[model samples]
Target: MPFTQAFINESFRFKTLLPLNLMRSSVENSSILGNFIPKNTRVLANIWAVHNDPKVWLNPQIFNPNRFLTDDGKEVIKIDALIPFSTGKEILKTIPLVKQFK
Candidate 1:
């Protein structure tokens, strides 16, 4: 069922349920990728952008479940960029349930 799992993963990435993750406010002055951020600034993770980024995914517009499979097609490779749900410790807990129900 590797392809089945891969299909589910690719489906999650192809059309994310929520494009932007829940906003998080900065607690203190900081910077990201050379961009300065002041305290209390609201930040959102664009799950849609990560899933469709050409730099990380080849022909992202095409929904290819095979992209999530290993060369031997025996396992589903987890892509670091595939964060359809908000990322955190809690997200790790939800993945298995999502797959089970799907």
Candidate 2:
């Protein structure tokens, strides 16, 4: 059943397919969290680190598929931290292919 899909999602989160997202070059000079990013600088988001951050997820290292389920266990909760495909402009590009597998 689809219930097992939650486990799949959790598995992906536990061990991300791509530990680091694709490198993106900054189009313009920018400052993020007080850190300066000059134009053309290559930046990559650590997908594994974000998935394992305690601040964003409780017991992140533990395998807990229940975290993605609703209180009544009827639906999957939309969590902002569960971004294995990345949350940038390329996010939507992966949806169609991902949904086909499900």
Candidate 3:
């Protein structure tokens, strides 16, 4: 399933609020603020680097939509891996309508 769908399913299954509360909790609990990301971190998030890491992805530089596609041809996107907002002090106020996966 797509990350958003999975999040929704899990949230529904657990009976939790959407978007804000979860995001807040994740930020609060993240190690990015401490060790993973440097202190005084002003570097623009290397989203490209994260998305294209050969160690994490099968084809680092290739634009393979199949990388995100599921066995059923629906796109199986991972949310945590593709956070457009990146980790920062600013919070995302809007929740996007994410594509669904089987």
Best candidate (score: TM-score)? 1
Model 2 residue pairs with clashes: none
List runs of model 1 lying over 4 Å from the truth: 89-102
TM-score of each: 0.80, 0.77, 0.40
Sorting all predicted structures by lDDT, with the top scorer first, yields 1, 2, 3
- What is candidate 3's local distance difference test score? 0.39
Location of the lowest summed lDDT over 10 successive residues in candidate 1: 93-102
CA RMSD of all predictions: 8.1, 8.0, 12.8
Backbone collision count in every prediction? Answer: 0, 0, 0
C-alpha displacement of 34 in model 1, angstroms? Answer: 1.5
Q: What is the Å distance of residue 33 in model 2 from its true position?
A: 2.3
Cα-based RMSD of candidate 1: 8.1
List the pairs of residues colliding in candidate 3.
none
Local error of candidate 1 at residue 94 (angstroms): 19
For residues 35-69, write the lDDT of model 3, one tens digit per residue: 45334433343444444446555764544545554
| Poorest stretch of ten by lDDT in candidate 2 | 92-101
What TM value does model 2 have? 0.77
